[model samples]
Target: MSEYRVLVVEDSPTMRQLIVFALKRIRNLQIEEAGDGVGGLKKLSAHKFDLVVTDINMPIMDGLKLVSLIRNDPQYKDVPVVVITTEGAIEDRDRALALGANEYITKPIQTARILEVAKKMLGV
Candidate 1:
């Protein structure tokens, strides 16, 4: 079986735990957690990841900025990003998508939905 690495970026410990727990359901996945976008970028720099699941609102840096940075970097440009955020507004969703987020999921996320999206993005 092939192994995949995933980075989960969220400031809230509880929310991060929930996301991590949900992601653990997938087979052959090695997940990492980052409390904020700056940390996420550091992890991205240190290691390659198959996918990134992030929240829009965070201290220091936000998910949209992270997505934009990831998109701009040649090394990580093609990597898929899923933004799971409390920003449910259409403009927020549109901005995330425009910033190269492959998937944009609103907050109060369904674990099943995240799993489905992650599987599809990773081709697992």
Candidate 2:
């Protein structure tokens, strides 16, 4: 089976590493990391990803802008995006959903929940 590619866009090093480690549980998953939205966009243009896992707060660019860009791009519109944010506010969740994210996950994510959401969206 081909490895599923996942792009993780997070500013915090610890959070980024945590996400990478958590997703590694999925066999045949290839992970890519980006520090912020700009880096995320650059990575996106360089390669196709099966899923995008992003954090809401970051410097240079944020998850919302990145989600907007992905949705706006014709070529990348089909790519599934799962927003992992600290903002648990209903408005934030609604905004992310309205921005075209396939799923929204709050911070301090459990490994099982991450796996569930990933499998649910990617149909693994």
Total clashing pairs for each candidate:
0, 0
- Name model 2 segments beyond 4 Å from true: none
Compose the digit string of candidate 2's lDDT tens values, residues 1-124: 6479999999999988878888898888888999999999999999989999998887999889999999999989999999987755667767888999999888777878788898887788
Which segments of candidate 1 are over 4 A away from where they belong?
none
Query: Candidate 2 deviates by what RMSD?
Result: 1.3
The TM-score of candidate 2 is: 0.94
Q: Once model 2 is optimally superposed onto the true structure by TM-score, how far is the C-alpha of residue 76 displaced, in angstroms? A: 0.4
Give me the candidate number with maximum TM-score.
1
User: Each candidate: what lDDT?
Assistant: 0.91, 0.89
lDDT of 2 at 34: 96
TM-score for every candidate vs. truth? Answer: 0.95, 0.94
